[model samples]
Target: MEYRRRTVLRAGTAGIAAAVAGCLGSNSTDDEGSIAGEELALATTTSTYDTGLLDEINAAFQERFGAQVAANAQGTGQAIESARNGNADVILVHARSQEDEFMRNGYGVNRRDLMFNDFVIVGPSDDPAGVSDTEQATAAFEAIADVQAMFVSRGDDSGTHTKEMVIWAEASSEPGGEWYQETGDGMGDTLMIADESNAYTLADRGTFLSMQDNLDLEILLQGPIEGGPELLANPYGIMAINPEIHPNVNYQLAMAYIGFVTSPEGQDVIGNYTSNGQQLFFPEALSDDPNFQQYVPDGWQPNSNGE
Candidate 1:
């Protein structure tokens, strides 16, 4: 679906001061009630920030509410931890199991499905493991392992890293050793490492598309779309930090942000975000299929065995 892409302001040192000045209005003084005081903190995954999605959303949110958003972009694990520690008011993350655990543990509330894209294994264009033709992710991983092909891993406990571990477990008893190298960095950096080393690495499709022009790696295995347990469906969700746990958190502001994101307007924006003219997130909650969530909770499911 096509929607207007919001203009992103360059919020460097000068732009930030100007934005703050604009947000504070004419009555605000230099010493009293600065724009920073009115800002809401949003802790989110790096993929969202690196792709420039958060900047667009933050600009819109600030314009609509006169309340700026201070975003901390990190791995999903770190984002969740920030929310838990009351360092952030809300969280946008991709790891469903971890998100559920956060809610169940009373660290967050109002967990809602947001948006999604699938993971893809990227490797050298020559396809040393011969995974370019394989439909099964396990088979592809096994082939890579059999040849001891160099593989790069985020190894940072990010959502992508978690999915990679699951795929490796399905393919073999172990996924770490000499052939598997861990970078402990975000998606963009990991992709660069993979490209420079001519190794394979799992990455979110959004990040892959955003960085495609700068990288030499090619998509080897896309997440399964069918086949039962073997499919790796990556879903993203938003959760508000429990106000009861963090009394200092901006609860109402956080809810407003959630409402904006899940609303039809916000979902429309998410559905339309694209890089290189290709849409990044697919909205699945509006689908008529009852098992849509079961298959692709956010938007995509792994393509297991080419099914």
Candidate 2:
């Protein structure tokens, strides 16, 4: 929870260059010192950690490997920064562009596809903006802006926040008005704020499912459209901090985590874990099962009274 409290400093021109330099210069064992025990450092987005999926998987991982994992859950941007600063041994996050850049810069290695979920637009059940009927996510966002519907954004450069920005760009809308608000918080807290204020917000399906019973928002848009619009399709990836880049990193344990999450047993656990009778995440790295392929982003069919 302390990870939630740390503010992400503005990554300005000088800050970014310095962060990169730090990553490059800190690879020496003398700089990072040595680990004292069999431990792993995991830095990741709040979505996965907040949904309780990581805790389940981590328990199994601990049981099998006999290693203590210190999970530092934060926004994807901050998690990447933590890796750049040599604070995390491995990372499991969903923001694709950032993840790609992290690897390109030589901070991480052995990136593996772990699982896939989708983002959804959720709002008051009355559908004030009529976003529920929009065929595309962009259209829904446009409508919300057009009607000046209250909207809450994570505003923390999180994975969900990144996806929301992408949708806004696709809609060609720059959403800033009295109706728009930023929580600068995680998914669960953002959802609660949206619920209390009757505002529209984008969320990953896993967190939405996990906290659905406690909120009043309804899913308005989901992914895997009739065509292949990929904005809503959220896929997670796992990677170890390049041990060569930071010698204190537990590369073997990081690899074990990568192996376990992509392994058959790990995949089984992912495929079976559900929230409110719906699967939270689907194992995608090595799975070709039809059951995992079946899903509706809307959370439910239309014209159903909360069935």
Candidate 3:
């Protein structure tokens, strides 16, 4: 695949970073030695950044490869487009359908299952919409819409935004007028705004948990394991941009990143990462184990094809 070369480069850098000084090497390099100026560019989602996962990954990657990883954290839609336009060498996103389309079009290759976290509906503790403890996301959304409750949406075409749209569609509600508000910002910012406005919003559990101390809102609903619906499963994946379609892309570096992130060592970091003493990402490799899958929803699948 055209993305193979860039993938190799990314993987090699990550390997080097891991072998050297671990995560400390990331801050030691200048922009010229970073992935942005060298062999790779990573485009990812805001959720990863808000949860502090990307920083950890970047530090380790830089230490192993001695190369800086220039990462643009945006909505999944924009991230995929970045790769399509040769603006990025790799992508880490949670939108499966969009990722599939990108791969089907030859924009990227060698997509691998990286990590996963579930989505949660957050709102005031008073439960204005009476959506707390709801098992069906669609029904919860319906109640929120019917009441015209204050709702804040990322509205940035991000993976979380896309999932919210799906739930709204399933609930047959259109967000408009005063009932809905759109904030084309990252997850952390959106949560802050939501808290200030006392509105409801859909967010990744990791981000919500990490930002919990700064906000007063509570989780209204969680995934099936947490009594939420099965449709709330959120899986994250990584893919390298296809060099054949965009000759300037660094295929080798992108692939190296893919290998490192999906490797056992990388998975261990992901699984062990915590905020407020709660694990943020659940490793797919251990998902089948009784302990690991205990909190995961049934019928959930790890996305590996990037599609």
Highest-lDDT candidate: 2
lDDT to native, each model: 0.73, 0.78, 0.77
What TM value does model 2 have? 0.81
Better of 1 and 2 by lDDT: 2
lDDT of 2 by residue, 141-183 (tens): 9999998999999999888888898899889677998999999
Candidate 3 lDDT tens digits, 1-307: 1222233332345443433332232334442143433445789998898899899987776666656687888888888877787788789999887887787687877676678889999999998899974678998898888899999999998899989889888887777888799999989999999999999999899999999998999998887547678888898878777767876666656665776676666777788899999998887633453333222232345689853
Task: Sort all candidates by lDDT, best to worst.
Answer: 2, 3, 1
TM-score of each: 0.79, 0.81, 0.81
Tens digit per residue, CA lDDT, model 1, 1-307: 1111122222244433443343333334441232333667788887998887888778766655567787887888878887787788788888876787787689888777788788887899999989877887788888888888999999888888878878777876467678889998999899999999999988888888899999989887776432322355777888777777877776656666776676665677788888999877766544454343432233444688764
lDDT of 2 at 65: 50
Clashes of 2: 1
